[model samples]
Target: MLCANSAGRCEFDGCNKYIFYDNITAKKLNASNVAHIVAASPDGPRGDKTRSYLLSDKLENLMLLCPQHHKMIDDYVEDYPEELLLEMKKKHEDSIREMCDLIFVPKSERVIFFSPIKNVSLTHIDNQLTAQALLPQKRPASTCGINISIESAFDYNTSEYWSDIDNQLKRDFDRKIGNELDSDPNTIFSVFPLAPIPLIIKLGYLFMDKTNVDIYQKKRVPDTWKWIETRKTNSFSVNRIVVRAGSNIALIISLTAEINPKRVTDIVDADIIYIISAERIGVDAISSIDDLSDFWHVYQTVCDEIKNKECAVETSVFPAIPVSAAFEIGRRYMPGIYPKLHIYDDYNGFCKTLTIGGDC
Candidate 1:
């Protein structure tokens, strides 16, 4: 039962080594062992008092662990104490249950064609696909040159101009795309980026953290669209803590360069804090997909910390990161397990909140 509860994998934190393997010849090899949270022997490590009298042979006192972890815990009882082992067992069991539930739920699929520019056309796409357009109210009849007539179609060359349009588009997306996601949490959204590159980045920022989505970019020659996947990045370290005052929220920051220290100091009162600084990798911008993957690893670690806590989560990014990396971050957040995400946006040199999911 313990192995089944752990989904046939190791229960150690962040160690998902599979215990049961079947080869092509149909021979099964098992490398898992049931480790007792409370030592079975009276003279064994962590075997004293209550454990000696009770819970020694009980199923509730056992945890499924890989061979290495089982040996390590037995060798170093001080590090893998009874309390910590019990907590890890509970968390791993809970995660398995959640995964089973998600596997059985039904999912609906939809394709969204978002074109905020004039020159791009979606007419060649299949008519059977559900198409939602975001065209301007009016456009010049002439087809000789590219003409943009959108309400917020401002110049993207200037930072101020792009920021204003980005904000406006954010509001628009919250109303339109956000509504669709709210209707069905299991909806598979396939998005095609046909707007300005900056707007595409803003579009990624607007996607509610944790929602399932796929991004695609168009290729010229034969005009084919390919799915873009976020690759795993190199590992990064984090500094995390849990506070007990103010808003019951977890703050996760990934700094590629540097952010305003004042902004971080302002939120020290949060229930939990997780900071992943750029100093770990010594890069201002995320140079590879591996960096983004590394960022995601830390993000998930922070998520694990606050999973059982009754609090919202706020993720803040410092300096500036690549749009692709931002998109990957938004994609990784699993809305069902994680609480509502409050993303911070800087407006007029002041931090503003952008709520994703949860009563927004």
Candidate 2:
């Protein structure tokens, strides 16, 4: 209840302040009626005595505000920040002086802590988290981090074994390329169709991704190989083969150019043959596909095992047979050996084969 005396004296502990009745107007005046310190709707039409207080004397809800002070609280409460209110409440607890500082000559003011509502950027944070989690998984384990040993096997032809390995690499490369090309028909074949050549040569690194390699290699190939262009002059040519992979072994060949190297190279001038095979080494961080570091380290290991001989560069590219001669022979005598390729070449670009054909 509001503090008022029998003679309408303000009974609040504050110094005497008396409310008087207007004798002429016959209206009794005193701080008796409960006043809402803050109005929920302050902007409503002012001075309309019909404006009602929301609650009275639940001390927890009501305040002992004079009429003028009541209006002031109402006006400011609309834009008040919850944090500022909570801070004011914390400073006012159990201390009249602090309460008076928060209010004007007050008894007590209630306290309330307003929690903040935050709007987070979910997409941005999620993307950052995803990158952090996935990057480590994608990284290849370093050789130092993992332990693996390699041993040499006595085989009839180390070159043949190497060739088989090269064939496996090529098949894998083609499969990967095929999967990528299924989406776009206009995309040309992979540039390194020669397969394991690129891996052994360290040139395959240029074709890191299938899409990029296809574009580059396609541009490099000439139609002359598929369609031989013979002028008035006869030219000597060479079929340069490149084998590549992450492994240390490689096979490359530069054969006499009668097969019309115009599509790839004009002359098989320099037969650059380098083979770096390994017998007992470690394989670490070597991708199953065209991997040069693996090839290099393995080559070194193989050379060391062979007492560091010059020919120990182990992997060598050799011309198994002349391309034209093979085609003619297969076509004439062993028609069964060669498939009757349609003149309308349906070559769907380079693809990985399941098996590396020995005869081809």
Candidate 3:
């Protein structure tokens, strides 16, 4: 096979020809020279035949460059010292670090907060399924706006159509609902640090619950029910949340009306745990609250519950403390929130942009 390093076009400034092999043998003629995708010797030219970086011959690591950039690096080597080269390498490494942690949130130990699930509660809509356990017993007079769940909606074969729905939801939310809230993309869309555990795993055995879910994107709502035409098996639960490198972190707040004690006890199984960065619930729509403030509010609420009534709910946050704040916390729990996280190396390219529960 052709040497991958010499097979490609050069990225070095002002270079345009194919790069040659490294050996510089006489049989091949004295025509071409090797260019490093990353630099080797600072004193040498860009594609200097004399030098080799650590990434020289690995197929995924090499690049080809013409002679011009080779000369430029040779001339500029003194000005661009080793420190500068090292800094550049670190910058690229930092870019792809996926700031997410994925672990199973057993149904028994997940956090639950008390708040109206919708912005405007309609009695006519309330009457439709009021008898089921899924609906909240009493609707609050205030609105909680909308909850965005990036739960898995479909499989790979269904990807094209479902993605269209996802896009439409995004557009509708941005153009209409976000405008009314005075929110920009940064405020409306965020990374939910904790991912949902697969429903099959939580059920613990072969069981079924039929319910309706109204999917919301911004303000547009679409109704979906689980029991009508589909089935779930015990074997279907998944253990990981797909996260991509460098996505906005979202602190997912999952609320369930009925208190289940076993859920809180399941915190031990989580692979990544996070603290409440911030929270905002039960506030007026006009509050203009940010996510961090929202996190704090939720944190306070949890503390109050623990102090007074002893709520069984527990919270797990992820990506550990931000890299920027390592010194202050030093990998310790903010309070006694149990089951803290062990920060793994940033996620690989396998990271996903959204968390999709395996159900649909």
lDDT of 2 by residue, 259-324 (tens): 222221222222222332222222111212233223333433432432233232222222222222
Look at candidate 3 and tell me the lDDT of residue 157. 23
Q: Write the per-residue lDDT of candidate 1 for residues 197-299, one digit (tens) a residue.
A: 3345445646655666645444353334432223533456667655555555545455544454456557434554666665443333344446566766776
Model 3 bad stretches (over 4 Å)? 1-7, 11-32, 35-63, 82-255, 259-360
Considering TM-score, where higher is better, how would the candidates rank from best to worst?
1, 3, 2
Error of 1 at 336 (Å): 3.9
Q: RMSD for each model, in Å, please?
A: 23.6, 29.0, 23.6
Question: What TM-score goes with each of the models?
Answer: 0.38, 0.18, 0.20
Ranking by lDDT: 1, 3, 2
In candidate 3, position 332 carries an lDDT of 21
> Which residue runs of candidate 2 sit more than 4 Å off their true CA positions?
1-160, 190-360
Best by TM-score: 1
CA lDDT for candidate 1? 0.56
Q: Which lDDT value does model 1 have at 205?
A: 47
What stretches of model 1 exceed 4 Å from their correct place? 1-234, 241-247, 250-252, 267-271, 279-284, 309-320
